[model samples]
Target: MFRTIFNTVVIAACFFILTALHAEAAGFKDVPKEHFAYDAVLWAQKYEIINGYSDGTFKPNEMITEQQFAKLLANYFELEIVEDELKKQTTTEIWSDEFYNSLASYGVPLNGYLHNSIRSQPVKRGVVAQAIAHLADAQQNLNSSIEFLLEHSISTGQNPKYENRDLQKFFGSTNNMTRAQVVTLLYRMDSMDFYYISDDAEAIHKNEDNNSLNERAIEAKKQLDASLQQNPSSSNLWNGNYRYVYQWGKGQYERNARYVTISSANSKDFYVRLSAYDGKYEGTTEGYAVITSAKKAIMQESIKGNRCIIEFEHLNNAIKVTEIDCSAERKNGTNFSGTLRKQ
Candidate 1:
C-alpha cells in the first residue's frame, strides 16, 4: 500500500508540473485557459518581446499601433536604438523616429506607413507580412508578400470562407493586426534563425554561396582595395567615397550629411568633390588637390570671388578636411569640415 501511494503521488506531481508548463501565461488574468493565443503570448512574455498593461491585463485582442509593432520587432531582433540629442527638441522628431530609422537601416521600406502622422494609427497587416518576408530571408522571386507567406506556410491569410481549399485565403492586408495575431505570427515563423545580420553595418547579405556576413565583408574589402589600387597610379589611398551621416539641430534627419569623393586626376593631383547638405542649406565644391605629403593634400577653389583653400589629411580609410577661408563655399550655416569614413 505504501508503494502504491508513492507511485500515485509521483504521477500526480508530474501531471501538475505539466499543467503548470501548459498554462505558463496564467499570470495574465485576461488570457483565458482556452484562448488560442495563450501559448504565443506566454512565449512573447518570456522573451520580453511584448508586455502587458499596468493593470496586469494582456489585452490580447487589442490592435497594435505602428510604434508598438516597431518596438516588438526591435525587441525580437535586439536592434540598437540610436538617439540624437539634436533631434530631441526638434518639431519634426517623433517618439518612434529612432525605432523606424533603425528598422529602415536594416532595409525595411517605410512605404509611408511609419510616418510620424500615422505613428499612433493601427499598422496594417501588409506591412507585417513584408517585415516577415524580409526577416525570414524569403525575399527572392516573391510576387507578393502575402503569396510568399502562404508559400512558406507562415500564414493562411486572416480568414476565409468556403472555396477551393488550395486557393482559398484572403489576408486583408489593410486590417489591423491584433496583439494575439502579431504574437501568433511571430510564433508560427519557424525560419527566423537562418540568416543573421551581423553587427558590422556594411556587411553584405544574400549570397548564393552562403558566405557569412563577415566573410562577405572580407571579400568585398579585397575587391575594393584592388579597385582603389587601380584608381590611383601609386599607393595613394584617397580615391574612394567617404561620408559621415550628421544630424543638425534643425529638423533634418537623413538629408543632413557631409560627403567627400576623391579620384585620381593626374600623376600628382587628386580630384576632390565636397558637398554638405542639411535640407535647410546646401554647399558643394569640386577641385583638384595636389599631394603635399605622404598622407596629406591641398585643394584650392575660388567660389564667388572668395578664395577657398582646404587641406586634406588622409588616414586609414578616412579623411579629415580642414577649411582655410572657405566662407564663400559655405553659406547660410553650411559647412563641410569634418572627418568622413570610407564608403
Candidate 2:
C-alpha cells in the first residue's frame, strides 16, 4: 500500500513539471504558440517590456497609448527618471503625467500625446515611428525621423514628404497602433544600437567643462554617423527649390530657371522640374536619374528630340552636370552643361 501511494505521488509530480514547461512554450491565452507575432510578444513579456492583463489575456488586438509605449521604452533602455514615486496607485502609474514630464526633460517627446488629458488617446503609427527613431539617436524633426524609418526598413518603399498636421495622407501614419504592432516595433528597434541620457539635462549638458560628458557626445556622433552611412541619405536628400542655369555651350545662353523644384523619393531615383523659367527654351525639360553611388548618378534627358546622357557629380551641396553631346542645335546625342544650386 505504501509503495503504491509513493508511486502515485511521483507520477503526479512528474506530470506537474511537464505541464509547467509546456505552459512556458504556449505563451499568453490570446497569443497562441503559432501566432506570427508570438516570438516578439513572448520576447517582450520575458524581458518585462510588456505585460498581460489581470484576466491572463495579452489582448494583442488592443490599441496602445503613446504614454504607455514611452514607459516601455524608458524601462527597456533603463532611462534614469528624475521623478520619485512610491504611491500605491491603481493601474499603470508610471505612465502618468509626471512620467511624460520626466521623459520630456530627457529630450524624449511624448510625440503629441502630451499630458494626462490626451494621454489616453491611442498613439498613431506616425507617432510611434517618430518616437522609435528618436530613441535610435535620429534627429528630433519629422523629416529626419521619417528618413530614419526608411533607412531602417521600418517604413518600406519611398519616404514621401507629408505635412505633420496632415497625417491622414501619409502612408501608415494615421492608423491606430495595436498592442502587437507596438511590441513588434519595439522588438525591431531593440535589435538596433540604442542610447539614452538621464532626465537631469542641466547637470550633464549645461556643464560644458565636463570632459566625460563631452567624450560621450563625441562617441555618440561617431555611432550616429555610422548608422547614417548604413542606410545612406535618401535620393530626396537633395530635393528642394533650386536656382539653375542651362547653357548651350561654355558661357552660351540657353535659359535661366528660378525656383526649379527637385524631388527624389528614394535615394536611387530622382526628378527635376522647372517651376517657372525665363529663357530661350519655350517648352520645358524634365530630367530624371538613378543615383549609382554616393558621388555619381546616371541621368537621361530629352530636350526637344535631343537625347543626351548626363553624368552628375556631387560637388559640395550642389550638383555639377556635364553633358556628352557637345554640338548645339540638333543631334540624337548632343551634350550640354548645367549647375544646380539649392535655393
Per residue, candidate 2 scores C-alpha lDDT tens digits across 1-343 of 9999999999999999999898575458668777767988988887888887653557565456555777676667665665433222123444454555444434443432222323444565656655566556545555566667666765542224654543334545554566787787667766764434333333433435543422433333233222121112345455543445444543223444333344433667665443323343322345676788877776565434445456666666566666564233233223345677753
**Model 2 lDDT, residue 299, Cα:** 55
Top TM-score hit: 2
**Clash totals for all models, in order?**
0, 3
List candidate 2 segments past 4 Å from native. 1-26, 84-95, 111-114, 155-170, 195-343
Query: Model 2's lDDT to the true fold?
Result: 0.53
lDDT tens digits, residues 254-301, model 1? 346666666544457776666655665666676778888788888777
User: Highest lDDT: which candidate?
Assistant: 1
Which regions of candidate 1 are displaced past 4 Å?
Answer: 1-26, 83-95, 111-114, 138-143, 159-169, 190-343
TM-scores vs. true structure, each candidate: 0.45, 0.46
